[model samples]
Structure formats: C-alpha cells, structure tokens
Target chain A: MPQTLDRRRLLATAALGGVVGATGLGSLAPEAAFAAEPAAVEPGAPDPNFVEGRISKISGHLLLVTGSDTVLHSIRITDGTSIWKLHPTTFDQVAIGDGLYARGVRLPDGTLAADSVWVNIVNLHAHIAAVGRNLLHLDHKGQRIVAHVVPGRSAAVYNGTPAISDLSLLRVGRHVQVLGAWHPDTNEIDIATVYAAA
Target chain B: MAAIRGEVSWFCCGTAWGPCGTAGGGACGTCRSGNYQHAWPNTSDACYAITHPDTCGLSMSRRTCGFRHYTTNLCNGSRVGTTIADCGPQTDLFCGERTCCGSACGSNRIIDLTPAAFSAIGSLSVGLRPCSVDTV
Candidate 1:
C-alpha cells in the first residue's frame, strides 16, 4: 500500500510538470508523448487469472467480477495503491462509478490475487453476450461475462433495456461491452457501457 | 557509419535452471522479452567487439522497461541485437561482454514514415518528407 501511494505521488508530480509545459522540466514533445501514450497491456492471454473485469457486487472487500469470463475475484485495496501512478480508492469506500484492472493468482482457497489492483475512473468497452433479470451477462471473446447495474445508473443499458425477464435478450450469442471497475474481491465490474461494438 | 547492433537474450530471477531465452518463461516474475525493451524511444548505442576472445555473457535486464532484442556479435559467435553497446566487451550493471544496454535496443532503428505519409492521395502525399530525426 505504501509503495503504491508513493508511486502515485511521483506520477502526480510528473503529471503536474507535464501540464505546466516547462521546457527544462522534462517537457515531453508531442510526438514522443503520443508514442508513450498508455494503453492497456492485457497481462497474459484470455486466462481467468489475468482477466480485467467490472465490479458487479462489493460485499465488504470482496468484489464479484462478471466480465471476460464469469469468475469470483477476491480483491484487496489498501491505502496509496495506485495504477499508472494514480491513487484510486477501493474497499467499501468505492462505489458504482469505478473500473478495475487486476492481476490474478491462484490462492490456496481457489480465490485470486489480493494484489495488483487498478480502479479506473473511465469506463471501458465490452460486448454484452447475455442479459438477465436486472443483470446483464456479457462476453469478451468466448468468455461468459456479467454485470450488475446500479439503480440510478440503470440508464446505461442499451436504450434503457429493462433488466427483468430479458433472459431471451441475453442470448447465447450477442455482442455488448461495458466500462467500470472490478471490485478488489468478488471482482464484479460496475456497468459503464452496455452497448454494441462496431 | 558502422551499423552495429546488440541484444539481451533473456533475464529473469527464478529457480529455473538453464536459459529459457525468453521472458515470462519458467514461472519467472513478469519476464519481458522482445524488441520493446527500452523505456525511452529513439535512443541508440554503438556496438563493438569484446576484448576477450572467449566467454558468453549473462542475460541483461533493464529497469526502465521490459523485453530484450538481439543481433549477431561481429567478433563472437553469439547472435546479438544491432545496437552499439552489443558489439563491445567487459562487464557492468546494464551491459556485459557482447551484450548492450537494453534501453537503446529497439529505438536505434531508423524511423520510417513512408507508409503513414503515403496514405493520402495525389502528389502532395508523395512530397511528404521527414524534416529531421528527433529523440525522445
């Protein structure tokens, strides 16, 4: 936790310098900056171990994740752990408006890594493969995926698709994407984009 | 100009015996392999021959980034990446023997924008020439 916090602070300081645009202060040229633009490097392949999912439920510290293959993830967020040097909070302190990027491990109890957590402030893209009563099961590739919609955020459904008796709509074959954080434990992602992919 | 190159075959800290010659192999922690090993882009190094005629060096690692690329060493039979540091000798933290600094491995290649500029139609696209090479 302390290490994450320190990295975040350092990244924040670097960002501040970047925004200021001072020449001698490591001003990143536009071309160079574009080249270094951060992109998600999917750790490993489509293994459930290194999957990045959305938070569907947060019961205490456990995050039930429901995307990129249905799997319950055990997440642990501590003070100062940051991604890309950004400090985003987890735990009960986290809410619906978040995203999660995690590195998985096979714990002795058949759970996953309690380490390497990233709560994204921005939503991501995923293809919805299934939908259920107040719950949408998604798929990225052949993986079975799912998401839980918050009440006020329910409008996120494509054209406000109701979440009841829509099991038919949640077909075995469909494409839908989502954007949100994966709870540290449980590994459920908050729904951000429940739309079609082009 | 002598076009030289060097490469770090593999680097990982694990109990595995023998070189996997690739990162992330043999349960090693977050092993990095490939050409994109340097943290900074557009960096370059000179390659040279090792002072000693014998000895294969250790697999080099980079703190700034992940992965290593290789080329054939001019003096030794070892194949290394085409970087200035790879051609030379001795030992140190970043590079030893014919190995080169991983930071300058991939970036040494000349920047090519012919495909990008030629995307447009008409003679205007053909006239697009790079003003100069800049390092990052």
Candidate 2:
C-alpha cells in the first residue's frame, strides 16, 4: 500500500513537470507515463508508437487526423494525456486543422492512446542570423524564419547544460536547433527552446 | 568502425515542402523526405571543407553518398539505418555542443537524418537528440 502511494505521488509530479524535464524524462520511463504497451517497431523503422498529422475532426476525446501522406489516424486523449498547443495546455485548446505529433501506445482497436501530444510543434535547424531584443532571425536552408522569444516561456540549452531562460548565450552566425510551435502557414514560430553552442 | 558519439538531427530534401527551402534532392540528387536517408559531415574534401567535423575534434571518415549508417537515439535506444543522401550539418558552428540521455551522452553535430528516418526513433518536437552512429 505504501509503495502504491509513493508511485502515485511520483506520477503526480511527472504529470506536471514532464516537458520541463526535457528529453531525459527525468527518471521516469516512457512506460511509467502510460499504462499501455507501445507498439513494437523494428530498429530503424517508422515507430508505430508515434504519429504526425493534422486534426481533421474532433469528437469529444477523439481526434481524427489526416497525415501529410493522407494516412488517417484516430487518437484518444485520456486523463493521463498531456497536451501542448504553443504551451502546455488542455484538450479544449485542440482544434481542427492543427498539426500534431503524438507519442503513445497503439490499442488493439488501432486507436492511439496518447500519453502526450504536441500541436503545431516544429523542430527546426538553422543559423542564428541575428538576435533582436525579443526575436530571432533564422536562416533555414536559405529561407528566413522569424522566431519570437516568449518571456517566461522561451529557454536555451547551451553546451549540453540544463535549460535556462537566459538567451544571452545565443550568438549570430551560430548553428542552432529551435523547438517551437509553428504559427501555421507562416514563417513564424514561438520559441520554446533553443539549443546552441556556447 | 566504433560507434561515434554525437548529436543527431533531421532535415528535408527531394522536393520537400515547408521549411525545407529549395533542398531539392540534396547534394546527392536522390534524397527524399520519405526515404531513410541522412547527411554526413564529411562526404568529400569539398564537403569536409564546409562541415569540418575535425574542428570539433572529430576525425570522421569521408563517407560519400549512398553509404549506409545506423543511428541510435540515445534518449530512447531506438535505432535506424539510413543511406547517406547529402552533405551537411556544419559541425564547426556548434563545436563542443553536447547532449545526453542519462549516462549515455555525446558531443558535436555529426549526422542529420531525413524526416522519415528521424521521426522513427525520436519526436520531431525535440529537434535534436544525443546519438551514436555506427555501421550495423
């Protein structure tokens, strides 16, 4: 009984602080975050546990998605599911036509029981052409991308260090990887994290 | 060859759309966003002149287009094998930058996979991942 109680406490903390923990998952196993087993995938193959597409329909907790290749998917959100739309958000923030990437388990019925879903999320690699007071101009594959630094939301990771909100370390002409939510049909993205070399 | 420790990211090519710019078949004229492909820092003396992984203290070999490499996402132990389809990931820019997944860690930007290859082992939302590259 005591063990179960402790597990619940740990889960509660994980629920609120998962993304804040970044890629390491903060000591929590991917299995610990959800009850279902992830679909088995061969090494170097497309992960069946992951899905990416645009939400074409939303009915209650179910999301109908159409992939960029026109593949269809049904994702079910649970109480344990974490949603992000520009920021950590709730289910209501999800809407039609929003692009999404989900990580979860595939149920027997082919429905994805999502443990986490990032709507409008885009990971971009580019050069920091210039840094403005609260914005960044990025050169991505010869195209310019405008990145907005959100106060209290945007963070930076330098030289493998833990994430910090101070973007001072970012420099022009440096290569960087930016993780943010795309502004949908625009060259703009609201910065979530910028990983750079110091 | 021993598995090289480094950072792995992704890009688009072969008429890819949205944020890919005019990537257009990459440097090899065969890369596609849907194919299992990757970009290596050292494809030739000319390509190496640009990426210069050695500046980051890495002695990567000149593996040209069509070469196969297996990449593992250290964050999750997921692995994927891809053919070299481009020359890229200017390593000199982010020299000394590193990332890790628990005890497993890596330094430098060594490889760039396609959307099909990268999203298979890791989430696109994460942008970059600590990785191990080897021939399997």
Candidate 3:
C-alpha cells in the first residue's frame, strides 16, 4: 500500500511537471505556447459518422432521432452494435425519448451503422446536499437530482485517488461529480461513479 | 493555442458493461474506457459542426485522431494528459450550462474524456468539473 501511494505521488508530480513544460510559463512567453491554432476541418459540414439527440421513434433495429440541433437521423443498430444505458446492455433495452450519442460509419443510404450507442448517459457536477443509505441527493446547477448508488457496481474516488467500490468516504454538502445513466424523462440516475475531494 | 477553460466530463468506451458493450473502441477505433484518452469536440469539420462550440461563444481548433491534450481540474488542481480518441460532448446541446468551484466558474461543454483519463484527475461520480484543456 505504501508503494502504491508512492507511485501515485510520483505520477502526480510528473503530471504537474508536464503541465509546466507544456505551458512554458517559467522561462518562455505564454504567447509562444499559445501560438498556432491546431489543425481542423471545414466548418458547417455535417459529421457523417456521429449523431447525438433524442430517440423520437424506434422501429425494429432502427432509431429515428431528432438531434438537439433539430437534425433528423436514422440510426441502424446491428448485432455488432454495443449499447450502454447504465452499463453495457442491448438493443431491446432502448426506449423512445431516451437521449443517445452514437458513433459509427455512415452507410450509402445515410444511415449510421452504429458501432456503439450510449443512451441517456449524463455527467453532472453537483453538490451532495444529502446522503442516505444507497442514495445521494444532488444539487446540479440549482436543480435537484436523485442519484442512486448501486452497490457492487457504483464506485467512488476521493481527491485524485484511484477508484474503489466503497463509497463510505463520501460526505454530505460536498461538491461531487457523477457519471451515470440518466433514467429517461426523470431527474434520477443510477450512479456509476462519484468523484469527490476527500 | 493556449489552454481554454470550460467543463470536462467522462464517458465509457472500449471494454465495459451496459450500453458501452457495443461501443467497440471509439470514433478513432482506438478508444478504451481504461485508457488515458479523450474525445475532442473539433476532431474534424463534421465533428466541429456537430459540437459547434462557437454556439456557446467559444472557438476550438480542429484536431484529428491521436492528438494529445492536457486537462486540469480546477477544484483540486489535478491534471491528466490524454490523446484524442473520439469526438464529444455536443456543446450546443447544453449551451449556457455552467459549473464552478468556489469563485472559479466555467461554462460550456468542451471535452469528454474516457473513464480512465477522467478518473486520473477527478472522480467519475462528480460528472462535470470546471477544467482547462490545452495542447501538449
């Protein structure tokens, strides 16, 4: 355990060093580090291979989606397509009105041959207003969110420590970040992991 | 360009459970949930169009696959370096969304990191964090 902690410390130090080196703040001008925009593609063109939106209709293996930007898409799910809600799941678990982020190849017919589909996955930074057995009441941008902790699956990381299944270290009134699957049409979510400062 | 401040979040890819099962790597086909990697909003023109960070009054340069970036959590000052393995966190979807720690606040979704990368600097349960992203 001592060795593990030492290693983590070393890694943390090295990461900090890398940040300093990248910024060149100590010896170099900030503009020197900031110059030159990175490479990019032309603007306003549609990404032929990715889509993010709400599922308006589900027909067989096809999902009719209306993007947050209001663009329409037809997403085709095949046997190879991976689906995740709270965790990895299947096509049958998907429902209408669920938000989705899909990545795949664009077919000749303009359908997204989805290789992966994540439904209602949300990451929110919130304050842990209260805690109960297997539950956390969160305040996200002033909105209340009920976060359910699933033992054996949900985990917690305090400060920058490695993740662990024990969430006992979590405290009320602390700011935390939660990554989990959002229950479609609800303010609740199944906690996958919670990040908090110890 | 210099590092830009905004929010950072995590997503699953490569090997995992639930909907992530079929995610097979990521857009770059090299992303894994356990790897120190990230999804950049402007990986390509089409990617930029979809994320449209500009809609939130932020401009991000287009970077392709394998680009390396460094992200720092403002709250704890922890940092992580990751490679671009996908396109991400459609910015415009949550336009005007803001997150903060103490007096430090940030708005807009600029980056989506894999579980591995995010956990390096922040916890996954605390989904959104005020962060700064830069090329390294």
- If you superpose only chain B onto the true chain B, what TM-score does each candidate give? 0.20, 0.96, 0.96
- The digit string of per-residue lDDT tens for model 2 on B1-136 reads 8999999988766552345436788788888665678999988889999999988899998888888898888877777788888898888878988787788788889999876677667655567788999987
Report the error of model 2 at residue B48, Å.
Answer: 3.0
Highest DockQ scorer: 2
Which portion of correct inter-chain contacts appears in model 3? 0.04
Residue-level error in angstroms, candidate 1, position A92: 6.3
Give stretches of model 3 more than 4 Å off.
A1-46, B1-136
List fnat per candidate, in order.
0.00, 0.21, 0.04
Cα deviation at B16, candidate 1, in Å, is: 21
lDDT of each: 0.30, 0.75, 0.68
Candidate 3: count the clashes.
26
State the iRMSD of every prediction, in order shown.
21.0, 4.6, 13.5
TM-score of chain A of each: 0.35, 0.77, 0.74
Candidate 3 chain B, which ten residues in sequence have the lowest lDDT sum? B14-23
Model 1 global lDDT (CA atoms, 0 to 1):
0.30
Candidate 3 structure quality by residue, lDDT tens digits, B41-95: 8898888887888988988998888888888787767666778888877776556
In what order do the candidates fall by TM-score, top score first? 2, 3, 1
Model 2 lDDT tens row, A121-172: 7667788999998999999878898999999999998877899999987899
